[model samples]
Target: MDDDGVVPLSGGVMKAVRLHQYEVRPLVEDVPEPVITHPFDVVVRVGGAGLCRTDLHIVEGQWAAKSNVALPYTLGHENAGWVHAVGSAVEHVQVGDAVILHPLATCGFCRACRAGDDVHCEAQAFPGIDTDGGMAELIKTSARSVVKLGKGVEPAAVAALADAGLTAYHAVKKAVPLLHPGTTCVVMGAGGLGHLGIQALRAMSATRIVVLDRNEEALALTRAWGADVTVVADGSHVATVLELTDGKGAEVVLDFVGERGAEHDSWAMTRRAGSDFVIGYGGTVDIPTIDVISTERNVVGNLVGSYNDLVELMVLAADGKVEMLTQTYPLDAVNDAMDDLDAGRLRGRGILVP
Candidate 1:
């Protein structure tokens, strides 16, 4: 190893999940292992790579125009691992340090990056989206995107928090000031991200939390996670949420499930002057012009999160205030993880361990 932190590479090969075409299952193929190539590059030995619904969308050609990602690339974005090697100038994280990735490698000098909103950095590289990602045995990232984990904390345990939990926390934190006591906050869905949103709300605010999910089992989990009420999301859920909120609606409605008519229902359950936050994607918000103008409701969008957000979320995780329920699959069984996610069989997040 060099005094500058650069380590010599072995020039080896490793297993990686690569998608050669859209609308088809990606396969586990032997690919060249990542190696440090830049002054700030840090290659991670992947411990866990989260299987996200967005990955399904990508495979279905949903992100084709937006990401413009070339095919035959690796696909796990929410990643956490140990630093297997680092570049010459990298110092914050050393080789063998446990860490979680930030999902985006950004130019630190950009206006958004300077303001801590690195998600919108002018020059950004979204691994697993537009470039090679962490679904492999090793992944290359920048030093700025790695957050060291606490002692005894496993990278696989918190890998999804890098994106799923981080996005949930970022959305919930934005509404913290609005979640005063006696205020009713409705969370739509209790899957991977929504469950974390419930826990984040439970930890950070005193607002009453009402969760809606199509699955009764998920509703039960929401209860154990500190929800004040739970509703089975069907055609009647909007009425039930309104009834729970005294014929009006919740001050904040977080739609973690944006598709399958959840968007309209979420908007319908929001208070007239309240805010509706959309975290999930793949659906259009089709409210009438009059509805927006007369109700004075605000529709807010959410991205992955910032570097500070990931750091703070880690503190919460380390203290045991937030934990994502995850089902682990060996790297070779990544397609099984994706199948469970697509079939809605996963109780929480699915993690691919390499």
Candidate 2:
């Protein structure tokens, strides 16, 4: 590291995909490699950076006001790689260690962090959203954000777990206590997160898993991942779920879409006193207050997982219980990857490799 806090780039520059303008495609360009700027910082050699739909929203300015991230930052929240360098204060991981990053860089001493709820840390930086992120040859994170992968686990194989899988795991983990052998856990919107939610629910609980998606293929894929039932997300889907659950609705309904009237359907399919965990965004959830008071339903919001949550999720990934249908792309092909993701042409999460 130099006096200016910029470490000398051995090769002078590295390739990265940056969002130079809101509502436009990210540009792949040569940029300086990241360096440790703080005693707790770590630089990761990017192996796989998962392209998420949130990146699309960021590019569209949906998150500009919320994240308040400056322009022209590299974008990729789901990251996994080997540790290339570490600040002096970092000790749990060292160079050459394969790791996945928790999306949030948080202070471990906060009350929420102390409670293992780092997602709600008083102060946090959401990489790829609120700061420069991985979609590059190198990325910078903090010591508290790195989780070492277990044996036989490669960075690319589990990169999507960084955010997408972690979020899914977090939601399912919350639903575990409410679920039992005969109970039904319905996952709405069998896309990237929904599919992963199915897998996490499968590995963590014995609840009968019901997956709903407009895409027949996504529903089929969820079935293979241990969804006990699949429902086409037509208008009648909610009624179908109620019928399947003997008119009691599902014990838990995780709304991954939470848009296009899906929220109403999700609420309709949730049983009395059951929980509705909202993960995905982009729509309004309009419900009558009478239903809330009569049903005693719990509406919860789910963000990404904590550092410890990532560690537990990695154990499931390393054991082959949860896997990502990763579509790999070179760093330069980020535009094409984003196109496929936006067009719904990609089957699973898109992973950019250096």
Candidate 3:
């Protein structure tokens, strides 16, 4: 151990869930402890890390072409922890402070970054996908990626807020400008992201929020989170949406499941001149050219939010405007957590604690 009481990476080891290949299960084994390699870097002793569907896709190698990550990498994006140690140059955070890890590292000099759209920076590194992440006892990250946790929020629940809640918050905020007192906002897929999407919309806008999900339990949870109406996935889903919107269709549709069917439904649920925001990462779609030209509907892809947005979300969480629903598992139960998430057996979100 070093003077700061952090185990030195040169000789110490920590357990991490590592993916060796595509379509194979990640193996939890002893790995070299991550070290602070940059002047602004800090090492965090992870308290909890949330499992996401994107981790599943990465484990299955579905994103290899787009992400360009190599095999045998650690996988986890949503994480919160206590600071174990910090480099000399790190100032905002110190050892022993509790913080939530922001997974995206954006180049601050990019055009999009200068315009306050750091999520779309020309150079971006996403933890768990592009680099090693916090599905372990300790993870190394830059000071810029750490956000101090507020009082009264449990670390395990806040773990889900790092990604699932923050992503949904960003998507909902984008639609806020379009939402009016009488307008309807449709949220498709009421699982992890969609559930939070419902809460974020309710907290940030006055639009009539409608939630759609194939699972009855998920729909019930959505209603519990302040959704005005809930519609189960079925042949008559579009009809139900049309009825809810009084045959005009929703003014904004946030598709939390980007599967082909969900994308089609999002388009079908939107009003003629409405906006459709795609935030999920599962499948693709092939919309007909006529559909775009005739309806004049706008489709936008939402990446995860910026660090600033995450800070704003933390404030909302601190103020109790947003609530995080999560189930906890010890680090050894990571596989079970992933299985529950994959099977849709979890009611809310799943977090792995170390």
Q: Candidate 1's residue-wise lDDT over 1-354, tens digit each?
A: 755556657669999999999999999999888877678999999999999999999999999999998889999899999999988888899989999999999999988988888889999999999999999999999999999999999999999998999999999999898899999999999999999999999999999999999899889888788899999987798998888888989999989999989888888988889999999988999988899899899999998889999999999999888989999999999888888999999999999999
lDDT of 2 at 75: 94
RMSD (Cα, Å) of candidate 3? 2.8
Give every collision pair in model 1.
Answer: none
**lDDT digits (tens) for residues 1-354 of candidate 2:** 766465544545889888989978989999888766678889999999998988888998999999888888989999999999987778999899999998899998889989988899999888899999999999998899999887667898889899989998999998899998889999988887887888889999999988898889877788779988888887888889999999999889999887778887888888899999998888788778999999999888988987888888888887888989989999989989989998888887999999
Clashes of each: 0, 1, 0
For model 3, the stretches where C-alpha displacement exceeds 4 angstroms are 1-11
Ranking by lDDT: 1, 2, 3
Residue 262 lDDT in model 2?
A: 84
List lDDT for all candidates, in order: 0.92, 0.88, 0.86
Q: Distance from true position, residue 223, model 2, in Å?
A: 2.3
- Say which prediction, candidate 2 or candidate 3, comes out ahead on lDDT: 2
The local lDDT score (0 to 100) that residue 189 gets in candidate 3 is 90
Model 1 CA lDDT for position 40: 93
Local accuracy of candidate 3 as per-residue lDDT tens digits, 180-230: 899999999988898888888988889999888898877877777889988
**Candidate 1 vs 3: which has more lDDT:** 1
Which predicted model would earn the best TM-score?
Answer: 1
Q: Alpha-carbon error at 304 in model 3, in Å?
A: 0.1
